[model samples]
Target: MTHIELSVLIPAHNEAGNLPALLDEIALALSGITPVITPVINYEVLVMDDGSSDDTWSLLVQRAQHDKHLRPLRHSHSAGQSTSVWQAAQLARGTWLATLDGDGQNDPADIPALMQAAIDEDAVLVGGHRVVRQDTKLKLLSSRIANNIRRRLLDDDSPDSGCGIKVIRRDAFLSLPYFDHMHRFLPALIHAQGGKCLARPVNHRERGTGQSHYGLGNRLWVGIVDLMGVMWLKRRSRLPALVTGIEDSELLRGESEAVTQAHEESVAAHVVSSRMEALKG
Candidate 1:
């Protein structure tokens, strides 16, 4: 199979109304991107239906018939966003993966630019930072507080850790440890794994069809425990040493000389045996 350069993964639960338009926007966005690795933009779209009771699955199936790039995945029950992204990462066949929210608030047009940023910066992860958030004042306040607390505790240096749109290398993503709500700490986790994380300004839009899935209950309150766990992981994590070159040693040189002498002796013996056999013949 031909390798895909990029995999666009969207995790949606009860986002039936938002996905149709989102998918279309993704297709349009991907069409214009000119990747450095491939002549044409080789990409696939994997949308995970996290056990939505709505018509999400059916819509995906219908869209797949028309769009070959669209590949829909599902869970029997509603798994959280982290699990959905985790499962999709395992299945995605791409050098890099681009993720977006299913609620249509994350602009698909920004995906190409982010992907380019990842390549240009040689970053394993390029996170989207929403400069002008189009959310309620309450939502904005809650998110600001959470981000500040997370930045101080985790020391991830991310301006917007909760932003959903991001481009990540598939291999780097798979190396990180997984847990519930891990998606929110991707920049920190990626940094912990010794991968470069860049935050780029992205366009954030207001929700179009359905209400926001997250609130103070699920967004802020539940995240407290997850935040503590991530902090522990960060403290315990260590980056790998930068290896310059293999060191030459006297013992290795001696071993190499011995192997060379043994091979020469074996060839000399073979030549003698061949001469003897020819004389006999």
Candidate 2:
């Protein structure tokens, strides 16, 4: 069995028109990556079709037949983007997960950079900051207001929390508390878990096809309630005390090297064990 290092997850709803090119771009962006940046470059693209009425799921099915890395998941009824991503994360077979917006505004070309940043900075989550946003005046204004309000309240230090491009450790992400709109508060949630998160500048493009799934109502009003919930969660968070004077104490040095090595070895061993179990079956 091949070991996967990264899983690029796309939580899409009615995004058939945008996925073909987006998938190609993800393939191209990931192809150039080598082990120099990470322990392994093997990756998968997991697209979650959240009950789209269009050809999204069919397109993924056809693409996955030809593209070995493409993995498609679906929902019979429309679950929100957060639900799509949460479900996909549980099924991901990679050590790391990179999320991209299905709308194509979040550039696939920036993924490698974000992945690299996550490694370099020792961050569990690396969020993309769209320095120059390409949206209408209304969207820009609404996003700005929302972002500012969230920053003041949550203080997650993310410049663009709405930017749908981020690289996160799969284990770390799974450890976070699940909620309806948890995707919007990733940085804060990571912080609540005593994990580090970094923000890096990334490219953002105008939507070429299909309508955006978000608007002021969903993006702002609903988010306000979610923000309060996250704040409550953060206040209640309590990290485990670090143990010392033992073999695991070695991990306390150098960005938790011992811990990372143990995790990698565990994942590899699990893969081999699964393969052996399959043979037995």
Candidate 3:
């Protein structure tokens, strides 16, 4: 497949009611974008069905037969949002990745601006921050608390990591650890890999159809464990400096040469020993 300029990834679980309209909106918005960098703006819209018992996968298949831009994937079991997105990310042919919620709450129109912001800031990741959420107070409060706790623990410097819409480099997303809820820590993942993330305000809308599939009501402790795991990964990670001295470079080169020379000497000694044994025999 040809490399796409942008891949819009959506992880859906029983979003058949919302997928059609969301796909249409995404198509129109993608069509409207005038590529300033590349002459051609080739993009694909990927929707991964997380083993939805509903007709979500069927709808995606139907859409793909007609819409060339629509790429569909289905999981045999219900993987979490992060895993679904990760699976789609692997299939994404685009150099840049754009992700949004499948529930129709994330505005696809904000994606263009988010891409622009990432370019302007020269950042590896651009995250959407929902300035005005259209959810219930309880949901909003839960998300806020989660975001705050995540920010404090991960120190990702992003105010709204839970926002579903995000634009990031494909390479950066690919480098992230494949774990549940890793999508909620993109900024931190990029930061850990010596890349920066720029946050931009985005429009949030109410879901038009179907209830939310997942919530963190009883999974608070699970989230804490995830947080600790991410923190551990970040702490254990070793990122190379952008520039290093000649001494350091030479040291690495010398070590490599030494190892190669030792291997060669060992091989030669083994050959001589084998030859001597043959002569004695």
Candidate 4:
């Protein structure tokens, strides 16, 4: 039996105080979940320190030394959460990628359930819907408005794209276009790529340390901008037309070349289409 590798990427800013607890929870969760009909299920926990001003990097490094499966990747400058996730995706060696916030709001115990949902549904992206968010009223209101607007505009059925506890296929994630706030649109992006998305309820907790990074107004503003960008991308996307043919060797080679060429052309066309859509917007 082939072993499946899972990569858990945690994007951190100044989350030193919360890292220890999050790591411990992850360790416990991974230990509890046994693989079915497989000799092994390899997993790695990656903490991407996004130019943290605190001791987050130091703590992550210390943890990595003790645990071979724990990896610490640091960014020289303060990139946003989406970039941190993208960078982690580039370094990840797992077939499946699960993203969680380092601020300790997301429960690591729910990760196993998310992974199971991915397997059961054959879903490319499985997002977490926070059953009880432990955020301030202002933040919650802002998120609610943003999520509603996003769902209406993007037609993505996900209830909470901001939950920050999502499991996705590594290849599907890497294929999406990288943007500053792309993390909030994973389900829509996955759907754009002809992939399936499922939303599962998960637990949300309050932050143990540090203040909220963005205020309600800023969160709403940024989300609006990103929503427009995603809508444009969705409108311009085009899927290839299906074709059927004989299984001759020469025909297969020719067909393969044609398919490759078509894919390249499609990508180029999408780029052009995206630019045009942006201009129209």
Candidate 5:
């Protein structure tokens, strides 16, 4: 099988009514962009049904049968959105991964733009900033408060962390430590690994079906705790060392002691230089 260039993972929870429309929208969005592969742009859409009580899994199965690009994975029990995303990433064969909520609030049309931004910035993570969030007043307020607190604490500069539409490199994402609500800390996490993160404005829409799974109180209270966890992670992050020198080895045991001493001196000098530069910085 050919490797997919992009894997779009949508985590669904009781979203049977929204799956068909979401799939159609994604099809339309992907139709315009040329994939990394020629003739057939190698792309796949994986919908993870997180133990939805509704007919969401059935709908996904039906879609997958007709559409080769559509693949469905299911959890036996309800897993949070972060867990669902992690599960999809494990199954994905794409070099790049795009994620969106399955509630139909995130517009698929914005996906191409996010992909473009990722390319332009050479970013490992490209987050969507909702231009006009079509959510309830309470939801908007809660998100604003959360974003503000997160920006201040993490200094990630992302305007809208809650936006569900995002594009990220698979390897970079996989390298980051996983947590329950890691999705909300992508910008900070990516930056901690020396990866660039760019945020671009995208379209957001009101839900056409089923009520939102999140609410203001849960977001404000639960999100505060998650933010604190992210801060602790940031403090513990450290930059990797770049090895500058190696000691030469003599193959012959009969080699003069002077030769070994010279090599050892050279290695010590290199280590001292590296330490000096690090101290200077």
Candidate 6:
């Protein structure tokens, strides 16, 4: 019943260690404790427990009881992060949507900054580019390579598509074509809709707990296939801009008549000039 302007979406799978602290940090950030920001951010934290085989669901239910801002949704089976996000988008009631990793590597503090960027730039999608990556060298290398490839191929101009922190206008996000890993291709997808994708450099933290559900192979090969698929979609996609207003139509008609009248007058003047020349001759 508390008015929700922003929906903070976190997709988790066996992320019991991260959620408690992440929720608290989000509360602190939204609590208006930061003197730089006003305490006007109204939001709800919707955690999609993606079929956690652990006590993640139980912990979330317990936490939800005490935290009025928290909302817990569960899937009976383990669905991937992309599915969780797509489903959460359908259920989100906020005017704006913000998504961050459940692993807590993405700072909740950055949410406010991204939200401001979303408003400032009139952004349909605001993606966080991690400035400092606190991960293994392997992860850093893989992510760098992936991002370069994605940017070059898609021409989306996004430096960090894999960064889990992104803010978007909920309606705009829902308008995009959905697929299994559509989360990774949001910038390009939004671009296809003639929507703006704003990028903000944000803080990235090291994972305190929970191993990555993704392996190196999961990060690279599958992404390539998905990237190719999205490229195909971009080639095939076209959106129509339709406006229905009698005033606009009438204005267009009036402009057309004016042009026609001017052309007719020019033709008449040319004929009169020719007749005058003939008479003189």
Number of the top candidate by lDDT?
Answer: 1
Clashing pairs in 1: none
C-alpha lDDT of candidate 5 relative to the true structure: 0.77
Q: Write the per-residue lDDT of candidate 6 for residues 78-139, one digit (tens) a residue.
A: 66788678667766767778998899999989888888887887778899998888888878
Candidate 2 lowest-lDDT run of ten: 250-259
TM-scores for the candidates: 0.82, 0.83, 0.81, 0.83, 0.82, 0.83
TM-score of 6: 0.83
Clashing pairs in 4: none
Report how far off residue 228 is in candidate 2 (Å).
1.0
lDDT of 6: 0.78
lDDT of each: 0.79, 0.78, 0.76, 0.78, 0.77, 0.78
Query: Model 2, 114-190: lDDT tens per residue?
Result: 88888888788899998998998878887888889999988768888878999998877777756677788898778
Q: Tell me the tens digit of each residue's lDDT in model 3 across 131-191.
A: 8899877677677777778889887689888789999977677766566677877788888
Better of 2 and 3 by lDDT: 2
Model 4 segments more than 4 A misplaced? 1-4, 33-40, 239-281
Model 4's TM-score against the true structure? 0.83
Error of 4 at 49 (Å): 0.6
Instruction: Please give, for residues 28-64, the per-residue lDDT of candidate 5 as tens digits.
Output: 7787555332334467898988879999988888877
Encode model 4's per-residue lDDT on 1-281: one tens digit a residue.
Answer: 22336889999999999999999988777774453423345688878888899999899877888897787887765667886787677667677889999989899888888888888888888999997889899998999999999989888888898889999977778778766678999988888777889999999899989887878766898889878888877777563322223433232111120113344345446656654657686
